[model samples]
Target: MKDNRYSLTGYHKETNEELWLWDDLPELDMEIGYKVGALLHYEQSPFQEISMIETKAFGRMLVLDGTPQVTAKDGFIYNEMITHVAMATHPKPTKVAMIGGGDCGPAREALKYKDVQQIDVVEIDPRVIEVCRTWMTQETDYDRDGRIHTVIKDGYKWIQEQKNQYDVLLVDRSDPYGPAISLYKRPFYQYVYDSLTDDGIAVFQSGSPYYNSDILKKTIGSVKKLFPIVHTYLCSIPSFPGGIWSFTIASKKWDPLKADLNGLQWQEAKYITPEVFRASFILPGYIRSKLEEK
Candidate 1:
């Protein structure tokens, strides 16, 4: 028989336990790892270091700047939550703008809605798209869609050029580290505010409150300054550092919590349901208290 036991090549393997340690939380001083099968693609993009690895458990995974951006097994949790909640709230979100979703996950998820007529994906690094297309084909395929437009440019600068344009803007940006740092700032949220229609809605993946509480608080504060309705919700994904992840919705008009889901049908969704959608907004007291602080 060919040696088909899960391969652990190129990963930091221990003598007794073979694992790939994701050392993202240094201050917390803990690491998470997955047994790996193969090293598919690794590259240094102008923006960040991109790597695609085939894991023993989570299927194909995309890691940017040493953080797991998406995995085949549970990507729908992140993408669907980010896209559907806001998309469902708006009565007619024809024009959608997705900033920094280079892997095509968010674009693919957003494309599922029949109401979304046009989707513009502004990805800063073309390398992330190329790698994802070549290696992570199973999770994403928005490049083939005629309605989707892929722009290789800085998302912050790109959003500034538009005014009252997009009905739904989904910021599927990387962690607030390198080129993505600007996307989490107050000015960018103002740009996002300007880029939306009067009834437009926006949602971005706020980092984990378990590990990145500061990010969640800062994001809520910045967005609250511009939008009358600013809400934060939680979604859990195993591949990310903390099992619990956060996304914030900012809207000029519609309140996502009271979204009328009278006719929305999410046929392809593995995670999000109408009931789950409403429950996601109901945060725990601790997290709510954090957001409530000045």
Candidate 2:
């Protein structure tokens, strides 16, 4: 896997772990795909890494087989959407916590809202952080910001050790499966509830609604049991299945949609306009009913 190409020849005999035939295939077939050098999946049809066909569309986005996979060249659309939504809603989220946002995109987006004075990003993998900094080199240098701090550790475990303080907490984690299993535990959600101020809110990336409906629904149900108000939003990502992805908002006191956008600050963004905000809330009938509120 010298240049990010691998094939699943078979699983380990006793471990049952996936065994891949790693070879340097950076150009032809492009057998593997990585977000920011972090392997997402091999043979994942929805996304493919195409070498030499980089996108000049955004800035220098890597268009994997014609699909926008990770950091868009022009902007951080998904990151802005996720962070700004919560920041706009909460009256003044002064102190914030972000779990697993190694890309630094979410931190960049959050810092724009001037009210957020301090942000603590708790990430598990030092390698992911190193890769993103070395590869993407997003403008928000993790090394310089006074408002932004890093606590390299297990997010769930760290959350359990906190007090009732944060105004908003964003879980910018990977999917709720595999290495991120602890993120979906009921106890972890409870800790998130406990770590927030009375009016604090938490936003998280749930998963693709089409493929993981059960997991998505269960997470909402569990969060609803913890926070009095919970709402889910959808965003479109070409790499993810169903074109639309699920995000859940949990708060002890706040409505994400009723948030006042004017109160928040944003430098500039390619997506996530006021109109986009309104449209994002209008979910399908089935999804609305599933949440038990319209």
Candidate 3:
């Protein structure tokens, strides 16, 4: 294949190439990939293959199946953005629910807020949590946080039992494939709508628009039917395959782009400022045009 910007996979074996190429997926001919320094831990769980690696540039990384999920160097960008955007928009968010954030990045970030009292993180795989706790404990301290409640179960089934309970609901799923496929559909979003309070806010990681526009488009469309205000935001994480990744925010009452973002601060956040939050909603011409199309 032509090693273009959209090249899906790249890794060097124990040869002189000096790097290992990891694909976001092996089936997709044009999905993006990354180079890692060395594999730290690899295991085949009952759910999926879990791997941890010491990246050459992005620091330590947590991989699910064959794709990159979280990285130590810049994981703050994704986790911080996902939590703060919704947390700041709501006037007083006390209860939060997270689905598929097995790495605990979202839970740890959410606990940093003063108003947040309890955070319920529902992850399907116990292995992802165990591996991250063992290898990436410094980056995420979800287990020690008294405000977090970790539950291992199917996210789709878990949300159906909750109704109008959470002030903010975050879906930090891996990808729109496998078990996460249902999370991208409208019914699950309807459940998400019912799972949040009247003025609740929710955000989920839509895949990279540059490489996976279809998922982003589908997510926006599905979320629009349930929420009055829906906005898509972007962040650039070096560990992820595409240079740009996206998050779609669905608000029942407030507009995230217009949320009062004055004087908001995060303890260890590296990215995500009021200026960056505003700019993230302003999508590029090609991506915006594609999203606007019928």
Where model 2 places Cα greater than 4 Å from the true spot, the runs are 1-69, 73-75, 140-142, 289-294
Sorted on lDDT, best first, the list reads: 1, 3, 2
Once fitted onto the true fold, the runs of candidate 1 whose alpha carbons sit more than 4 angstroms away are: 1-21, 138-141
Give stretches of model 3 more than 4 Å off.
1-21, 24-36
| Candidate numbers sorted by TM-score from highest down | 1, 3, 2
Overall local distance difference test of candidate 3? 0.81
Look at candidate 3 and tell me the lDDT of residue 207.
89
State how far residue 198 of model 3 sits from its true place (Å).
0.8
lDDT per residue, candidate 2, 82-166, as tens digits? 7877888898889999998776788887877777789998987665555556556465556677998878888989999987979
Alpha-carbon shift of residue 181 in model 2 (angstroms): 0.2
* Steric clash pairs (candidate 3): 8-31, 10-21, 11-20, 11-21, 12-19, 12-20, 12-21
Q: What is each predicted model's overall lDDT from 0 to 1?
A: 0.81, 0.68, 0.81
Q: Write the per-residue lDDT of candidate 3 for residues 239-279, one digit (tens) a residue.
A: 66667989999999988767787635554677877788788
True-vs-predicted CA distance for residue 289, candidate 3, Å = 0.7
Candidate 2 TM-score versus the reference: 0.76
**Number of clashing residue pairs in every model?**
0, 3, 7
Q: What 10-residue stretch in candidate 3 is worst by lDDT?
A: 1-10
